[model samples]
Structure formats: structure tokens, C-alpha cells
Target chain A: MAGRRVIPGFGLSLGFTLFYLGLLVLLPLAALVVKASSLGFAGFAQVLGSPQVQAALRVSFVSAAIAALGNGLFGLLLAWVLVRYRFIGRRAIDALVDLPFALPTAVAGIALATLYAPQGWIGQWFARADIQIAYTRAGIVVALTFVGLPFVVRTLQPVLLDLDAEVEQAARSLGASRWQTFSRVILPALVPALITGMTLAFARAAGEYGSVVFIAGNMPGQTEIAPLVIMTRLEQFDYAGATAVGAAMLAVSLLLLLAVNLLQAWTRRKLGGA
Target chain B: MAFHRILRSFTALALITAALLTQIAGCSSKDGDTAQPGTSLTLLNVSYDPTRELYKEVNAAFADDYRRKTGIDVRIEQSHGGSGKQARSVIDGLQADVVSLALGYDIDQIAAKASLLPADWQCRLPCNSSPFTSTIVMLVRKGNPRAIRDWGDLTRQGVSVITPNPKTSGGARWNYLAAWAFAQRNGRDPREFLAALYANVAVLDLGARGSTTTFVQRNIGDVLLTWENEAYLALKEFGADRFEVVVPSISVLCETPVAVVDTVAMRHGTRNAAEAYLQFLYTPQAQDIAARHGFRPRDASVAARYADKFAPLVLVGIDSFGGWPQAQARHFAQGGLFDQLYGGR
Candidate 1:
């Protein structure tokens, strides 16, 4: 009885799930791996070991991490407001969160680049302060943050809405401070959702090219992203080299995502036990 | 929590389904259009960045001319992007009946990699299969406040040069080589001169149009090193009062080549139409259209008619550096001269 499932046709659904993922994701990844492997192990290592590629990868990974962490914090606040409060134009505000998702990324990148150029309205203020945004690593972060925001917000919205306010009230009634209520009573349950949201945001930002290309200064060793490095290789007609970089990105992304999943599962188990 | 999980999965599934549906629709829509070719014909012109306006006029004119000549309605579909990218698409099964890329090396690549056309495809047409030509030039703010006139002026301390990455832009490869040619003609070390010039570059946009935007729209760079036509287009599109074109003392001749993909054209039964279309580019009528669009016409009459539009310079052909293949391998290839220019520092 305990093992009996409420949903029927488990095997059929599971087969469909595998088929869908195989066709959409695994097939392309397999092709990439095959192309990258054609270069041989030494050739692959040589392609990935270049300093320019290394710098680009470092910039890409670090910026994506920063962008994801930023989205996680701000997205939490946004989701909290949408779920916790009712105000004038709340529905509009709720719909506004999806604009980043709806707007074409290239258009978003162009708009952001225009807004952040030194002569631009927002950038002129920064220019006065002698701080550059567009054509810098900071600009890459800004574009990534813009594109990844919706991922964090959409992922957290449901989890935030499902969060019971009674738990916080009960904790406060028991003489716990507000911070205590948040940190002790509420945060643990939100931990899994928050990590999942951040992971999604991180993944989205890591693979983002359309929005970052226009904003990134694209100096080979300085502001270039890993994806741009792949493109540069492709432009030179180095198919194997391009796939080598792509395979590296894929492996790194998979490992990071796997780590995040394990972390999420551990937190869920720990919470369930607690 | 269970309900939320289901909702999230449903949304993901729906998005995936929608994407697949669109993909199917896109594929199916292009499938049968060429099956029965008598009533109407389609020719796909895979081209590069700045040729959008040029081909827009050419394609319309050619469609009309073809219908009048053959009594068959012809629709020429145009696809434009970075030169190398467009070539790569054709190699990767884009089914283009004709390719008018920004450089011969790109067409050579399609021939070498895909074998869609013969190795001597350029010899198939006149003027090395280049119906038109252009030269690299400097675009500066009106009055030329920086007084940037030549390649040497671009490397000056205060002049911020805006040019696309050579690896991505066919025009930029010409820009790089023209600068190299200038250095060589002046007996300066080409590599050092290029290093200094790149040091003055404000941004390395991915393509020619992007660099034009960086210079003209974003107002970042002091001077833009670009194809002459693009510089002219920038002035014509964005007010000429704001900027001016500076013809350098020496520049590389950019012979944008056109070729019919023999295999694809034969497969699509568009061989005759495709060949005629390319041949039409050499006509005086089309040469006039090319001149108006800022391209240097091959026809002497058309070129003389628009003489003032193009400034005279010692135009160095690609043959001066062996050819496109050798030049590309030495300069734009991985660990080559262009990469070495900005590599370590």
C-alpha cells in the first residue's frame, strides 16, 4: 500500500520523459561530445588551456555566479512582495516580472547597451563619477542579471506563495525576534526553493550570449565570455576547437548543476528530518 | 508543494512543446515551395552583413527582370549575417542556391568543406567572380577634428578606432590587411603598427554593422575603420552633417564575390535562374544600382558616373599577400598575427 502510486502508467510516462529529453537535450550533447572527441584528448586539452580561453571562462563563470547571487536576493524580495502584499497595480507588477522572459534577448541587450553607454542617460551619471558600465565586466553582469532575473523570480514565486505565514506568526508569538523567525522558522523551508532558483539563474546566465555580446567589451583576454570564445573559434573555422570549448562548458555546467541538485536534496532531507 | 511541482513541470513541457511545434512549422513551410518550380521559383541568396540594402534592391530588380525575360515569377529569398557565419551555414546544410559572401575565402570554404561547388568556382565568372569592389576607409566626426587621414593616424594616442573583430567580419579582415599593407608600403613593422592601432580601438564589436553602431550611434569611437560602402551607408543613414569619410592613402581592395552553389542549385533545379541572377549583377543597370548603394561598380561607365562618391587610393588587392587562403591562415587564424596583436596584454 505504501509503495502503490496515485498516478497511473508510471512506465509509460517515464518512457515519454526519457524520449523527450533524449531527443531535445542528450542528442545535441552527444553530437557535441563526438565532435569534441574527434580532436583527441591532447588536442582538446590544448584548446581549453589557452590563456585567452581561460580568462574568458573565468569571466563568464564569475560573472554568472555574481549575477545569479544577485538575482537570488532581489528575486526573493520581489517574489515576497508579490506573494505577501496587495497594492494598486499589483497585477501589472506581477506581469512585469515576465517582461525579461518575453522580450527578445538581443533587443534587451541592445536596450541595455544603449542605456549604459557612457553618453547614455543612466551612464552619463556614472561617467560623471568616472565609472564605466557598458564595455566592461560590470556590463556583462548587468546583462546577465537582466536575463536571469525572470528565472529566479518565476522559480521562487510558487514556493514563496506556498510558504505559510502562520509559521512566522507562531514563531513571533513564541517570543522569537523577527530575524529569528525568518532565520529559524522560515529560512530552512525556503532554502531548497532559493537554491533551485539560483541554480536556474546561474545556468541561464552562464549560457547567455545574445544579451552579453552587445554589452561585453569583448576584449579577448578581458571581458570576453566563454560563449564568445566558442564563437571566435567557429569564426576561424575551427569546428573541433569550437566543440572542445563547448564540451568544456557543458561538462562544467553539468557538474555545477549536479552539485546544486545534491545540495538541494540534502537540504530537503535535512529539513524533512528536522 | 505537489501542486506547485506539477505546475512547474507543465509549464516546462508546454514551452518545450511550443518550441518543437514552431521548429516543425518552420521546416514544413520551406519544404514544398521548390518542389514544383514552373509557376514560381525561389532562390536563396546567403550573404553577409552590409549587403542587406544592396541585395534588397538587387533582388527586387532581378525578380522583375527574370519574370520579364523568362515569363516565370521568381522570388529571391535573402539571408544575411556575418560573412564567415553565413558561409558556415551553407556548409552545414542551409540549402542556399546562391552565395554572395563578403570575401572569396568564405566561398572557397564552402567549396572546400561542402564540395557544393567546384574548386575553381571563382574562375567561372568575370573579374574573379567579384561583380563589385570596395576599399577600406576611415569614418570620422565632421570636420575631422582629430585630423585622422590615414592608417598611421588611427594609432595616435587620442584616436579611438572602432572596427569589428576580424575573425567575425569579412570587412574587418580587409581593414586589418589594409592597415598591414599601409605599414608595409611605408616600411614600418606591420605587426607593431597593428598592435598600436588595436590599442586605440574602443570596442571590438562582432560584426561591421555593430561597429558602425558603436561609432555612429553610441558615439564611442573617434574614428571607424570600415569598408567604404559601410562608412558611406553610415553617413547616408545617420546624417552626413555629423560625420565624414576619409579615404586613406592606401587601402585593401575588397572584392565581394558572388557564386552559385552548383550542387544546391542543381538539386533545387535553380541552376539557370541562379547563374542568370549572378550574371545580372555584371550588367550596367545593376552596376548603377550597386554604385548608388555605395559599392564600387565594376562597369567603367557606372563607376565613372559615381566617380566622386568613391575616393581614389592605391588599392591593394588580396593577391599582394599571396591570396585569401594564405592571408587568412597567417593573420586571422588561431595564434596568428591578429590574435598576437592583442594576445598577452
Candidate 2:
């Protein structure tokens, strides 16, 4: 809480934030578990043990990991370009970077499917060239990449802006190479932001449904993702099956996110000490 | 302090820009699908989005005819989504006049969701009041490369099957029903056959069209469980040489029903139009177009002309499963047996 109330009702606002988050996020998830409790142990196990559920878990988390890893490396490059350069239509390019964040997941999915199908605008070219990007493991990654990019870019943007150019200049003054200054100084400050971005991206990709559904081609063992599987359970009225898969996914992702956040905190502290 | 003000202003500007963009987008969508003006008769037809074009044409025809006969304006407002979602919407008081959904059971959910649609509503209507029906057909590679002639061939180890999530697509119910029937006819218990069948499924996308993308666009599956009209459309849209329809030995009848939402119509004061609109669904003109779209016309003679399109079957209607209510409770209802078989871990 603020020591002095510069703004009226700071505590109230914080309470409202917690209450809103609790109502919207925590309660629904809790209800999901509560509803799932009606299922006995055998019932729960039966729901989770199905081949389809197993396959979906693999697709959801693995693709999310692949997407996060891929985005982390590439999103950094993209952020650097945006921050360091003044290109023609630079503002327009900046606006376009947020398109994924703005567009509906459903519309994005449909557009990508149309673009990358075997006979789609771009897909036709890929087919002729013997490359495939739609409806395989590749398409899921592409979708994850689509929704995840803005997170990394937006996260790193301000940090990049706040970064002191003098540090790089001082390193160069000390006869340190360009690569050495980047690898040691700039990269460290950006680590916390990068990890935050990757966490956001990974979490988003893990639960992503609409865009992935259109492009994933929904192959059971291969292209099937966990969210779609949870949906299938919901449709079949298998609330327990949906929840079990969801809970499992949440646990795994939470562990991963914890590790990432801890790494980020460590990085931030190191940068602070320096 | 001055620099801090600029930074705060910069964030405020970005938030404003995002907010303005979302508002414009939101307002534009507000009336994107508004109903026609000055229609004394309002008919709410819960339906699929793909059928919007077809319904537009049919509604145009119906409006002309309905106006000529009644001397009053009539409009059909179509609500589209996954049929199950749509059904729940109506059940939860979407104020639907006549419910034309992807399946009988979805309409049945309106009755089941509350006391809104009666439990025995199916029995109350003749032939369950299902206006139109479809069957599942296989969309194969342009040349049928894998020679996936039937459902059995789909299980030939390496043959991957692509279908919409049966949970979302009412048509996928036909797809699942057909698969079960295929297994049952082949002397395998429906359960074992389903497990094996789902084993070959590679991608279980969320909707029918999405699954079609997997088949036609991605070329991932050996066979695709698709609607009859969609199969016909795919062949026509893609080169005829691009896809072939494989009729199974026994096909499941996908009955799409329409019923008057008595409660909603009474509230909206569209009862006459709503009731007439549902009655008009059985008209000869509607049947013709319904048949043209590869949907089996409920009318007799028209179905004969189109008989060749549909495979001969033992007529596995929802009646065989003790009607819509029982079938819903047994199979597709939440945690129903189908879930146990397919989704159960």
C-alpha cells in the first residue's frame, strides 16, 4: 500500500483488484476443481487415462514450450530492431506489431488456415516447394508464434528504452567489443523482461484453442492439443476429464513459470548489484 | 518531474489508442448482423453459420411467399454457432421462435436445459419434427490415394482419420454414429471399435470446417468425416479430381430439427410467424433447396429423386436409442457414455 494516499482509496482499489481477479480467475478455476470432485478416484483416473487425454497433454505443453523457446530467441531480435532503428513507415510497422494482440483468436486462426493450407495463398507456394506449414506440428507452432510475439515485444520495449546507452559506450571505451557489451551488459538487463515475456507467451500458447484448432488439423496423437481435448470432454459432458487435463496442464505450466520467474528475479538482482 | 509526466502521458496515449481501436471495432460489430426493419413477424432460427448463405436464399424465397400469402412482413433472423452452444443459448432464453439446429438433441437441450422445452417434446412432434437430415461421407484425397473406401479402411494402421470434435459439431455426431454403426455391423462391440477408431484419429479439431481444413488443406488424413453437402461443396470448390465421397456400408442419419419456442415467441409476440415459419419448413419449396444442398428432404417424392445420393441403411434414427432424451442422457450429455468411451482416460 502507498504510505500516503496521493490518490483516494488506494486500499479499496487494491481490494477491488484482488476481488475482481478472485471472482474472474480464481473462483472459476476453483469451481472447476469442485465440480470435478463429484468424480470418484476411479472416475477421475478413467477420465485422465484415456489415450486422447495423454496425446492432448503432449501437444499442448510441447508445442507451448517449442513456441516459447522459439519466440524468446526471435522476439528479442524483433524488439532490438524496433528499438534501434528508424525505418520508413516505422510507426505503421510498430502498429502492425500489435495486430496479433488486437485481432480475435478465431479470426487469426481462420486467416492463417486460409493462408497456409495446401492450396491457400501462401500454402500453394509451400506445396510446390515441398514445404508444409499448415495442419501439422508446424501449424501449431506458427499459431503459438502468432499470439506470443506481441507479449515479448511489448515487454522488452520499455526496458530497451530505459536502458542506458552510456553503459554500452563505457564498455566500448574500455575496449570491450560490441558483442561483449551486448552479451554481458544489455542482455542481462533484458533477461528479466525476456523471461516475463516468455512466461506470458508460454502460458498463452498452452491454453490457446481457437487459432490452433483451425490450423492444428486435430490429429489425436500428433496434432491434438490439450485445450481442444478439454473442450471435447466438455462437449461429451465429461467435466472431470476436462478438469483433470486442465489441472495437469496448470501444474506443469506453473512449475515451468516458477522456474522462469525465479530465474528472472535472480537476473534482476544480479543486474541491481552490478 | 517533467520527464516523468511525459512517460505517464506516453502510457496514457497508448492505452487511449488501444481503447479507441477496440471501441470502433466493437461498435461496428454491434449491428453488423442486424435484422431487417418493419417485420411484423419475427422468426428466430438457431442455425449453423455455413448454412447462412443457403438460409439467406431460402429466407428470400420464404419471405416472398410468406408476404404474398399473409400480406404481412416476415423476417427470419439466424443465430449461428456450434449447435450445442446455440441450443444452450436458446435453452437459457435466447428468445428463439423456431429452433433449426444442427441436431435434434441440441433442440432437445432447450427442453432439457430448463422446463422450457418439455422432456417429451420429441414424441409430441410427428417424426420428431426434424425438418432436414444429413449423413456422414468420407472426403478422400483427390484421387483416393489411400483407397479409403470405407470406415474399416480408416483403421488400417497408418490411415489417419480427421473429424471435427464430436462435442462441437452436430454433424460430427453423425460421424461418430456412423463409426459406431460401422463397428457394430462388423460384429465388433461399438466400444472396442470406437477405441480403435479414435486411435487412428490424428487431429481432433474443434469444428467440422476446421476438420475439413485438415483434410483438404493440410492433406493430413486418409479420410475425413464430413457433411454430405460439405463433401459435395469440397469436390466442386476444389477440383472434382481433388476429392471423392465414400459412402459407408451403413450411414447414420443426422436429423436437424426445428421447433417453435412457445415461451420465447409468446414473449416476443412473434407466435404466428414463428409457428407458420416452422410449419413452412416442411413445404415443398424448402424441401427442394434442402435436397439441393445434399440434405434429405423430409418429403417423400423429393427424397426418391435424391435417393441415389444417400446410402441404403437400416434407418438408425434417434428412435433406436429410445429417442432424443434418452440418447442425450446415454451418449452426448455431459459425462455420457460417449465421453466415457472417447474422452475417459
Candidate 3:
């Protein structure tokens, strides 16, 4: 009786879910793996061993990590402000969070490049301090942050809104300080949603190409990202090498995402046990 | 009640899936139908960036001439991007009727990968399939602040240079080769000189126009190594008061090649219009338009008319480096000199 389903079509629903997932996601990904394998093991090794490819991979992963971490923190704050507060223009602020999602990435890239160029308004200030932002690694992270922000915010907003304020209020009444209430009470409850948001942001940033290309100066081994390296190989008509790099990116991203999912599941289990 | 709700959702989901499947089937069937040419002909001209303005004028003139010659109305659709990227699109089935790219090698890729044209496609047109030619030159900041004069000056310690990546940009390959040609003619090691020159490049854009924007709009570099026509366009678009074009001592004659995609042309039945369109480029009227747009005209008389606009510099042709095939293999190929030099991060 405890495991009985509410609706009686579980078998039908499960079949539909598996069929849709297999057709839409699994098939395309299997095709990618098949194409990559056609390159042969030695060919894959050669592509992965190139310094340019290695540097590009490093830049893509590191910048994506930094950008996702940044989004996770700021996105939580933004969601909290939107859901917990009743400030003027709060609705407008809430809507603004989704702008990055709606705006074309290429347009966002151009706008960011303009705002951060040495001669631009914001860039003028940086230039005065002898610091460069556009066309550097920092610029790549900024572009990634711009594109990945909405993923984190949109993912966490509903969970934050669903969080009952009474829990915090009760903790406070029980003589728990504000810091303790947030760190112990609120944070644990938010962990699963936060991890979900961060993983989504990280995955989006890792595959981002249009926005990063405009701001990333594209200096080989210095600012070039992995997707751009793949594009370069494709342009050179090295289809096998391009597939090899793509497969490597896919493998790393899959592993990272799997690890995050495991962590999320573990946290959920711990919370349920608690 | 719960069972009813689940049944309702399942019905809705099934409807959506059926609709999506039907839509997919419709799209696939539509694509399988072959395109037919009608009385009014439409040609897709896939060109590289920086040729947008030039092609606009050329297309307009060609359309008028074709209409007057044959009672058929011609409409040309233009698509532009980085040279190699444009070629890749053609290879990936963009169905371009004619491809006027920045380099012969890009067209060769389309020929080899898609069988869009024959191996000796260049022999189909006059002037080795190049309608017009330009050379690499410097667009410097106002007052020549860097005091940059030639290819050697570009390698100076403090001058920040802006040029596109040679691997993706056909214009950049010419820019790189022009400098290499200069160094070689002066008894300097081409490799070492190129290394020094690249060391001063502040930003390597993916295409010619991107580098132009970097230099002219962003003002990030001291000198921009770009095609002569691009430099002219920059000076004309952005105030000439803010920038100056400096002709280097020696440069490469960059031939802009054109080819009709035989497969697409044959399939669409626009082969006659496509061939005529390319043939029209060799006309004196078309050469005049090319000269007006800063491209060095192949016709001597049309070139002479624009002699004052162009500076006389020692120009080395691509043939000097064993043509596009050999040059592409030796320099821009994967793990070649370009990769070896900049591969290290």
C-alpha cells in the first residue's frame, strides 16, 4: 500500500518517458560517440596531445567553473532578494534576471565587448588603472557569467519561494543567531536546488561559443576556448580531429555533471534522513 | 479524479508528440524536392566578409547587364562570413550558386569536400579565376604615432598590431605572407621575422572585418595589417582624419577568386546564369566598379584610371609561394608553421 501508485498507468508513462529520452537525447549523443570513435584511438591521442587543444580545454573548463561559482553565489542572493523582499520595482528586477536568457547571445557579446573595450565607457576606467578586461581571460569569464546567470537564478527562484519563512522564524525564536539559522537551516534546504543551478550554469558556459568568441581576443593558447578550437579544426577540414576534441569535451562534461548529480543525491538523502 | 487528470495529461502529451512527428515528416519531405529554375532566376552568391560592399555594387551591375542581354530577370542573394567558414557552409549544403571567396584554397575545399566544382576549377575563368586583386597594407593611427613605415616596422618592440588569425582568415594569410615575402626579399629569415611580427599582435580576430573593428573602432592596436580594400573602406567609413593608410614597401597581390558551384548550379538549372555572372566580372564596366570599390582592377585601363587612389608598391603574387595548394599546406595546415609558432599558450 505504501508503494502503490496514485494513477494506474505507470507502465505506459514509464514507456513514454524512456522512448522520448532515447529518441531526443540518447540517439544524438550516441551518434557523436560513433563519429568520435571513427577517428581511431591514435588520432584521438594526437588531437588531445596538441598544446593548443590542451590550452583551449583548460581555458574553457576553468572559465566555466569560475563563472558557474560566481553565478551560484550571486544568483542565490538575487533570488533571496526577489522572493523575500517587497521592494519597489521588485517585479521588474525579477524580469530583468531573465534578460540574458531572452537576449541573443551574439548581441549580448557585442554589447559586452563594447562596454569593456579599452575605449569604451566602462573600459575607460579600467584603462586608467592600466587593467584590461575585454579580449582577455577575464573577459571570457565575464561573458560566461552573463550567459550563465539566468540558469542559476531561474533554477533556484522557485525553490527559494517555496521555502517556508516559518522555519527560519522558529529557529530564531529558539535562540539561534541569524548566521546559524541561514548556515544550518536555510543552506541545507537550498543545497539540492543550488547544486542543480550550478551544474546547469556550468554546462551552459562550457559549451558557450558565440558570446565568448567576441570578448576572448582569441589569442591561441592564451584566450582561445575549446569550442573555438573545435571550430578551427573544422574550418581546417580536420573532421576527425574536431570530433576527437568534441568527444573529449563531452566526456569531461559528462563526468563533471555525473559527480554533481551524485553529490546532489547524497545531500538529498542526508536531508531526508535528518 | 486523479486518474481523470492523468488521463487528460497523457492525451495532451500524445497529441503534441503526434503533431511534432508530423511536422518533422513534412520538413524532411519538403527538403527532398529538387529546386527548379523559373523565368525569373535567383542566384545565391556566397562570398567572404569585406566583399559585402564590393559585391553589392557588382551584383547590381551584373543584374542590369544580364537583364539587358537576355530578357531574363536575375536576382542574387548574398551570404557573407569568414572565408573558410563560408566554404564550410557550402560544403555542408548551403547550396551556393557562385562562391567568390578571399582565397583559392577555400574554394578548393568546397571542390574537394562537396564536389561542387572540378579540380581545375580556376581554369574555367580568366585571370586564373580571379576577377580583381588587392594587396596587404597598414592602417595606422592618426599622425602615424607609431611611425610605422613597412613590414619591418610592424615588428618593433612597442607597436601593438591587429591582424586576423591566418588559419581562419584568408586576408590574414596574405598579410602574413606579404610580410614574409618582404623579409625574404631583404635577406631576413621569413620565419624569425614573422615570429617577431606576431609577437606584437595584440588581438587576432577570426575574420578581416573583425580585425578592422578591433583596430578602427576599438582602437586597441597601433597598426592594422589588412587588405588594401578593407583599409580604404575603414578610412571611408570611419573618418580619414582619425586614421591613415600606409603602403608598405613590399606586399602580396591578394587575388579574390570566384567559382560556380557546379553541383548546385546543375541541380538548380542556373548554370547558364551562374557562368554568365562570373563572365560579367571580367567586363570593363565591372572592372570599373571593382576599382571604385578599392579593388585593383585586372583591366589595365580601369586600373590606370584609379592609379592615383592606389600606391605603387612591389607586389608579390601567390604563385611565388607555389600557389594556394602548396602555401596552404606548408604554412596554414595543422601542426604547420602557424600552429608551431602560436601553439604554445
Candidate 4:
């Protein structure tokens, strides 16, 4: 088999990949699914259908989506700056983008909470305006955005770096405006990478707990997130209910990610075939 | 060629070093597990947060007293976290020789789930095995800017409150019930009062310490609903001049219970030491230590000595709500009263 393939050890490498993924990812998820299945389909639906659980899921998904959209806009601008411009501290800025990935999420949460609490340094300004940030839904979004920023910026950097400036020059030569060049020529090429980055960010933010919990205020059916609801159930020793909610979250996340993937594929086929 | 050979040699050296380290770790852990007859014994006391300081003093004093009396050197180890989380650890087999958790329900969980101890473990010791007790109190900013005097004041609009999530913090459960008791005692609808109280909460942190941070360090809320000891702790930690504790007219009596895990203790052959360690907590010396750490000592004389330290208040015990099991099921459970009340907003 090794001799037959252009790349050696096809069978061995594929086996290793499967084993690694199965051990690290699929095993725990399979256990979660098994535990969740104990609730049966009806019990699972009832658990997720509860008003509190519904509210929590809405908070988690909506905040994660908003955070991901914010990341997509800002992350693209950041990656573009690093790739297309020559500036002092460019390398430092690029390295700084990975800080969120390195810092413990609890630390980021505490820091964010302290910085955004009503009387905090940044929060004081908002307070003067009679606007609350920490202990509100806005606070969860802030924490999620902090955690998911690196995912977007890191994902887009490579693709942005590889994008040729000559393509923009070619569009300019053909009497296209700057916006037209970016929208028609440059943007279509970056769409797939942007979607991938946004999806990764959304997935990360959706599952975030430690950072968001500190700032969430955690009012049920209000600021409460789905992860906190699972934690609450576990605290009550309702393992079956906890896993039921978790399984529902996992299924929904999978569906959303799959849709994004399909959209990415469609964009790739349209552009690649052209 | 020489670089590749050097890298290979280093890789082999790393593997050899890793193997050697694991062998040493295995040997040391094996040695620490067994209790030899006359030399020394080990007991792991799994506890909850806010008792860290109290236990530190108790552990040191008890260790000295045990060595002096029995001449068998006893070392007590400790593991602390959120109450329910610590209980879950014991249930999942953390080998806790004794568990001195924040509430009765947590210990009850160990009995029910793990069978590590008898279901009647609470009756095994005096005072339901709670050597010291605490009550829910309000910690307010200095000068009481909001004019917050009681549980009723907490529900007032424009008065931000800070308390942990009852689902996560044992102390928060007591806080919630304390407010409920106060409302009932005042002849108002308890559920509506609770809903209003939580409506004013600025942050529902996961534990007592986190809520203290929100109230003290971050300065987010107008008041902090917390354990009596925790309120005092915040005053001592952040300077008494910055905050003051208000003993509500009525509050819930927080009974933090302890017990020996029969299975773990018997297996380790440290049952005697574990029982003795808990027994030591009831002594005058340990009770005094508990008082200094801001807990209301169960010892009458010790509590009297510190009576001036704690303000007078009517404290309703867990029995008022049909004990922890019923209270836990009614209030803190999923879609229970806490969820129902807080979810309304």
C-alpha cells in the first residue's frame, strides 16, 4: 500500500489520525451521548424545552453569534493590516494577537470583570452614561469576544499573507474602483477563510464558561448561559438532565457548523471553478 | 549527519529521564498511602471555601494536640472548593477520609451516591456533627449609603445587591433562605420578595469569595449577601473602614457538617485518627479558633466570649424548611423555587 501511494504510509497515517481523534475527541463525546441518551428522546426534548434552558441556549447562541460577527470584522482588519502594510511594531502586534490563547480563561474573565464592573476603570465611563456593561448580556459578549478574537485573527492571517497584491493591481488596470476590486476580486477569494474563522470563533465562544461566568451575573432566563445551566444541574446532582441539555447544545452546534461548512464549500466551488 | 545523531541521543536521554521520574513518583505515592502502627498516619479532609482560614488554625492546633495526647503523629491534609464541587469530588472517589463540607445536603449526597459512609452520619456526632455555625448577613459599603437596614432594603429599587448563584454556592442557598425567612416573618409574600431581591443583584458569582470580590474589590454592588464569617472576612481583608456587616433581623442558621467516610477511612486504616481529628474540632481550643476565624462556635463559653463580635439576630435553622433535603429539592433544584423566582425577570 505504501508503494502504491504517492505519499508513503497512507494506511498507517490514516490509522494514527483516526486513533488520535477518537481518543482525544470522539471518546468523551461518545460518553456524553451515551449518558444523554439515558434521558430518552422525549426527556431530552422536555429538558431543552424548559423555559430556563431555552433562555440559556438563546443567550449562549446569540452572544456567540454577535461575538463571532464582531471578530470577523475586526479580525479581518487586523490580519489585513499585518499582511498588507509595513509598520513599526507589526511583529509585536502579530504576536500580541495570540495572548488570549495563552492566558487562562479564568484570569481573562476576572480581568474583564474588573475592567468592566460598574465602578471599574472602563466601566466608570459607561456608568456615567447610565449604561451597565459587566453583569449584563453585553458583558458576556465582551468576554466571549476576548476569548474568540485570536481564533479569527490567527485563522485569517495565513490566507491573508498568501493573497497577492498583484491581483488588486490587475483589477485597477482593468478600470475597477478600489471598492469594486476589493468586493469583486479580493473578497470572493477571502470568503472561505473568513467563514472558517468566524465558525471557529462562534464554536469557541458558544462553549465558553469560565470567562463568561464571571461577568454574566447569571440570572436565570436572563444573563444565564447554557454552560452555566449544565453546571447548575450538575450541582443539583441531575446528571441525566445536565447531559440532556449538553447533548442538545452539541446537536445544534453541529448543525450550525455543518451549514457554515456547506456554505464554505459552495463559495469554494463557485470561485475555484471560475 | 552529526546534528541528527545529537538530536536522537537527546531524545533517548529525555525518554530515560521521564521513565525515571515516573518510577520515583510511583514509589513515593505508595509509601504515603499506608499508615504504619506507631510512626504516623494521614487523613484527607475535603472541605469547602470560606473555611480555609478556620481549618488552617484548627488543623495546626489539632495536629499538635493529637501528637501530645496519643503520641501518634497525625497529619491532616485538606482539599477545598465550591461546596457542591467538593462533594462531587468525594462522590467520584477522591478518597476523602473525612468531609467537612459547607452544608448537610452535600454530605448527604456522599452517603446516597458513594456509600462511603452511613446515611445517618449526621447523627453520629453531637450538634448534628456541626461544631461551629454561621448565619447569613449583609455587608454594606461604609456609611450605608443606600440606607439598607434589612432584607426589605435589599429589594428596594436602585440598591444593587451581590450574592452568589444558589445553585453553585452553599452559602448562597442560606442567603436565599435567610431572605425568604425574613420576608415571611414580615408578613409579605416570600416568593415576590425573593424575586425582587434577586432582581437587584448585580452579579451572581459562583462562590462566596467571588461575590466578596464583586462587592469589595470590584465595588459593583450596594450590598453583599454572604455568610457571617465571609462578611467579617471581607471587612478584615479589605479593611473594616471600607465595609460593615449588618446582621439582618432574621436569617438562616448555616450548619456546616463533617463526617468520616467509613469506606475510605477503613481502607486506609485511619478511622481512629479521622474520628479523633473531627472530635478535636469540638474542643474549647478549636472552638476558640473557630470564633477568631469569625464562625459562631457551638461551645457556649466560646460563643459567649465572642458574643460582642457577632450581632444579635433571630436565626432560623434548616429544620424550619424541613431540613436540607427538602429545602434543596424545593429551592435550588432545576425549575425549583430559585429558578422559578429568578426566571420571572
Looking at model 1, residue B69 earns an lDDT score of 79
lDDT of each: 0.90, 0.77, 0.90, 0.89
TM-score of candidate 2 versus the correct structure, residues matched by position: 0.81
Candidate 1 lDDT by residue in tens digits, B93-180: 9989999999999999999999999999999999999999988899999999999888889888878889999978898899999999
Candidate 3 regions off by >4 Å?
A: A1-20, A271-274, B1-38
Predicted structure with the largest DockQ when compared to the true one: 3
Over A76-119, each residue of candidate 3 has an lDDT whose tens digit, in order, gives 99989998899899999989999999989989988998899999
Ranking by DockQ: 3, 4, 1, 2
Off by over 4 Å in 4: A4-8, B1-38
What's the DockQ for every one of the candidates? Answer: 0.43, 0.35, 0.54, 0.49
Residue B309's lDDT in candidate 3? 94
Candidate 2 lDDT over residue span B1-345, tens digit each:
544776799999999999999997775444222223443455778886346655776787888887877676787888877777677667656777777777777766677655665666655555667777777788887677888777778778888888776777787777887887777778878877777887788777666776776678666678888888788777867777877888766777777777777777665666667666766667888888888877778899888888887667654665666765676667666556666765542
lDDT of 2 by residue, A97-151 (tens): 8999899998999899878887788888988989877878888999999999889
Each candidate: fraction of true contacts kept? 0.62, 0.57, 0.79, 0.71
| Whole-model alpha-carbon lDDT for candidate 1 | 0.90
What order do candidates take by lDDT, descending?
1, 3, 4, 2
Report the backbone clash tally of model 2: 15
The CA lDDT at A215 in model 1 is 92
Q: What's the TM-score of every candidate structure?
A: 0.92, 0.81, 0.92, 0.93
